[model samples]
Target: MIERGEDWVPPLPTGERVAGAKRRSGEGAAPTHPAKRKAGATERARELRLDETKAEYRLWGELRGRHLNDYKFVRQVPLGPFFADFLCREKSLIVEIDGSQHAESLTDESRTTWLNSHGYSVLRFWNHEVLAERRAVLDTILAVLEGQIHSPSPGLRFAPATLSPVGRGGGASHG
Candidate 1:
């Protein structure tokens, strides 16, 4: 039955199918095609999530695709089910911006741990540091890439003070 919402036009011949018909719907009826999964496709998906943060945006402009100093870095990096602010595949590094809200979330800790387990180093910068001390933050990232600052150890220590009170133990706070 041709419903009001369904396509009224006739279907294409079996052999005259469109190249993107199956891709747009994310259905894999046929054998997997390597060309459909390019090496940079993951990076491209991450790039779609960029937002306009004054500091983050500016940094992005400077370091987009590692344009700055020719050091390759991808913005809005997708890892697993989450997205990182920035990622360098070559160095297996991720840079994140942590706001006051982030200080209280166990989710960040879990995310960091997951990334670490996958051999990717995670560096988190406070929002204030990103805004007020942008250069220092960038410098720190560069230094890490330059092999000056050793990556965090396998067992990273999370300071209790940074965790949300409830995250530490108590129930969720109303405020």
Candidate 2:
């Protein structure tokens, strides 16, 4: 064994506890807290909420506290293994804001597929779209929340959310 400082210890994985470390899946190996695996995601999600993007901060202003047609939305929610930007449990919907970094991103596709498979619809908007066309974005979100945009394609990376026939919904993209 190598000598080490008393203060040093191996970093533990999220949800891991010394009490439950030895449990196996045969007879009695289940964790004491079934939600242990989410502990990490939960912490990370909280951090994301605290460090929200400018676009997220703007859109959240409209979605928070039932400001949008009485729909209650939560931010930085953990679902399965991913954290969603915003989620409305009543409608089983998730809304994500992306920067140019997300254009044509396979990761977003896979995450959307996973969320869709788990009975949730996802809506994505570019950061530019959110900041430049606040009304239309909110309208698109409102339309979705009201079941008017059922089966929303949710704006592919290159596409934009639609509020009307005028623009992508009625605005131009900065990105």
Q: Which candidate number would show the highest TM-score if scored against the true structure?
A: 2
Q: What lDDT does model 1 reach?
A: 0.54
- Alpha-carbon RMSD, each predicted model: 17.5, 15.6
Q: Candidate 2: how many backbone clashes?
A: 0
- Using Cα atoms with residue i matched to residue i, what is each candidate's TM-score against the true structure? 0.58, 0.67
lDDT digits (tens) for residues 1-175 of candidate 2: 7743311222233423322332111122322221233445656777888898999999999999999988889998765556778887666668889988787444565445444545566788889999999999989888887878775453542222222212112133232
Q: What is the C-alpha lDDT of each candidate?
A: 0.54, 0.62
| Deviation of model 1 at 54, angstroms | 2.2
Question: Model 2 Cα displacement at 79 (Å)?
Answer: 0.5
